[model samples]
Target: MKLLSRLVIGLVVLIVLAYAAAVGYMYFNQRALQYDPQGPITTLAETTLSGAENVAIPVDGSVVNGWYQAPAPGKPIIVYYKGNSGSFSAEHERYQQFVADGFGFVAFDYRGFPASPGSISQQGILDDAVAVFDWAAQKGFPLVIWGRSIGSGPSTYVASVRDAKALLLETPFLSAVTVAGERYPYLPVALVMQDQFPVNQWILDVAEPVLIAHGTADTVIEVTNGERLYQLVPNKDELWIVPGGNHGDLWARGIWRQAEPFFERAVATP
Candidate 1:
């Protein structure tokens, strides 16, 4: 009996140590696991769209590089906030569509992306987001801001305080911490994540019309995140949960059909 007890105690000690080591590894490498700036994303050989201009906006001691073109008459400009990875240039064709439809747009690389400089953090990105909106507000076009995936953090933050006419979230999450908890259920991720972008909390404050688009098959952020966020929005416009649509494919599944009309209604002419 004494020998069996000793073996059981030793096994428990080993288990505890292994669990501690796993938690430590995750805590140290959280950012690397979350924000991936080096991965390859879809890109065009070159952007050939007409009338598009390159721009650099200074925000809180950092410069954000991007492309901008003003909309034609009676159209609201689309201020696009992209995902955590890749440059905005990957969406040049979408920009072409925006231009083709007479909608002006500004899409930029967030801080820590290739041309933009600054460390990535929840508050830092939020600060940069508001500054980007302020810069585009100079054009004085009614604004329809949209965010995709991880971009939901800054997009929701901007809508909370800025004068944007509409807010759109694509495959969004309830919050960064909530996502971490989903992916790392074994660990106490909610307590350790450093860059929690409490998007659910921010969504409660958005007054303008808000639209949420999520795929029922989105495995990255999941559809429930969008549905839950939709419930929190004060001026909920529409909840577009596409059937069989996955993350990054909602656009192909006719999201623009929904988004365009939402924009028109949000910024409808009196």
Candidate 2:
């Protein structure tokens, strides 16, 4: 009986220590764990959109800012959702490509990322996307939602909920839990993750034309995730697997050359 009692005490102590460590880690690294929407985003928003005007849309009681480059009056407006890091500054060149393609382009930084003020969360990002979409609709512009990396989650969610003309995902993951599992297989991510972006579930509900692109050599979030996501969509969606491309270098490596044609075809249809 004494041996069993000692065993029980040891197990209880171990559990307590584990729980405390998890809590401590979450507390101290909360900012990093969550999104830090500072620095580069501000500089990106301030710069002109090359050929279009810069605009700000209010979201979550704060101004969610962006750049608007008008191509033709009646052309479709491309609303871009960037990756987790950096702001519009880092993404200006990419935005210019869409504008030069004769599409009105609007790309913005999420809250806590530069000019915007607010904490970031999975749902918060979706809400912000919706707000931007509404703003575009009000401006009499047709909307195409484009998401890259982490931004894919909100873009997919918004596309599922709204009348998006088309959906574009670049280097997207299947879900947050799937990504966390890949990075930390030991942790119970399914239960611990507070911001779960289940793109697999949401993609099923999206009725618009969808285009998913991923680099074949992507190391950060593998191409498999994007493939899995593309496979899950009920509609016949387009998937582009770039040869010898890394996560962020898809555009730099000329993936856009193929993408621009795909976008032209997709946007032209309806």
Candidate 3:
């Protein structure tokens, strides 16, 4: 009976140690799982957008690469922050929406992504975004910051810092840690996550006109996160819930048509 008791206690200790090790590993390497700077490159040459000029904005002694199409004078420049997976080149078609709408467009690859070079960090990307905003601001265009998926965090963050004519978010989450925790309820994301892009926390003080478009059928980063984020925006904002639209299909559901009127209201507002 004594030996049996000792064996059971030893087994419990081993399980506890293993669990701790797993948590430690996750905590240290969470950034790798979070940011993918090498997934795939999307080039501007592949798109049908005419006069899309290659742009380089210097930040922290590094250059962030993107494509820029200046709109007609007196129009808003649509600054897009992309999701984690692809580079700016992969986003040319998406930018075409803004171009077709006669809006100036600028979208850059985050540092450590293919065209941009630097280590990826929450603060690092935010710094890059601010630099890009400063560059765009000098071009004398009214600013409109837009973000999709993971990009929404930076979009909200920039809107809080800079004076934007409007802010747009698609399929956004409350925060990276919040989404991770939701997906892995058994894990302690708050304790282990490295970069918490807290969009909800940032948008609390943002007073710009904000538009949040989310899909009700999204299983990844569920629609509830988007709802919570929209509620936290303490500003002139609108939420468009696309019924039966999945994570990546909201654009197909005439999102740009919805956005056109929203942007009109945003830019027209004082």
Candidate 4:
């Protein structure tokens, strides 16, 4: 009986130690999981999209690079925030689409991404976004903030505080904690997750129109998160669920049909 008691105590101690280790690991490494800053890539000018110009934003003592093209006065301006991977050039086609539609477009690399300086943190990205938004807003154009994947966090953050013509989120999660909890049911993500965007919370405060597009087949962020976010919005007509669409390809699956009308409504006619 003595030996059995000792073994039981030892097992309990082992489990406690393991749990402590996991909590420590999560606290330190959560930032890495939140931000994926791929090293620098091609400049905006190199992409060769006509009328594109390189803009510099100073944030946290570092210069973050961005691309901007202003449309005619009174046009809608898309302040686009991209996903985790790839440089700004990866979305050249999308930028072109905005410009071709006669809307001004602005996109930037997060601090640790190529051409941008400084390590990325949740606050740092938000700061960078506000800086860009302020810069664009000064031009006196109506702003529509667009966020995709991880970018949705900052997008929602910005829109909640600042007024926008509209806010668009693609493949967005309810919160980082929610996603981590879903992925690791055994772990305590709610307590340890560092970069919880709390989109559900922020969306409540947003006054402008919101368009949430999520793919039915998205395994990465999952479709349920998008649904939850969509439901929170007062107006249900703005939600777009692309059937048979995955995380990366929802835009290809008739997203533009909704996008065109959303833009039309968001942008005021001169």
TM-score of every model versus the real structure:
0.95, 0.87, 0.95, 0.92
Which 10-residue window of candidate 4 scores lowest in summed lDDT? 39-48
Cα lDDT over the full model 4: 0.82
In model 4, the Cα lDDT at residue 165 comes to 83
lDDT accuracy of residue 136 in candidate 1: 94
Model 1 weakest 10-residue run by lDDT: 37-46
- The sequence of per-residue lDDT tens digits that candidate 4 reaches over residues 179-217 is 888988988888877677788897788877889999889
Error of 4 at 65 (Å): 1.0
lDDT for model 1 comes to: 0.86
- Residue by residue across 9-108, what tens digits does model 2's lDDT show? 9999999899779866755664577564656444543545546665779876778877876657657888788888867657777777777667787788
**Cα misplacement distance, residue 160 of candidate 2 (Å):** 0.3
Which is better, 2 or 3, measured by lDDT? 3
lDDT of 3 by residue, 1-270 (tens): 999999999999999999888788778888888876775665666677877888899988789988899986657888889887867677666688788878888889889888888889998889888888889999888888889898898888999999988899989999999989987787788887878998889988788888898988998779998898887878756899988988778878988887777777877877
Query: Root-mean-square deviation of each candidate, in angstroms?
Result: 1.7, 3.0, 1.4, 1.9
**What is the lDDT of every predicted structure here?**
0.86, 0.79, 0.85, 0.82
Candidate 3 — which residues are off by over 4 angstroms? none
Error of 1 at 200 (Å): 0.6
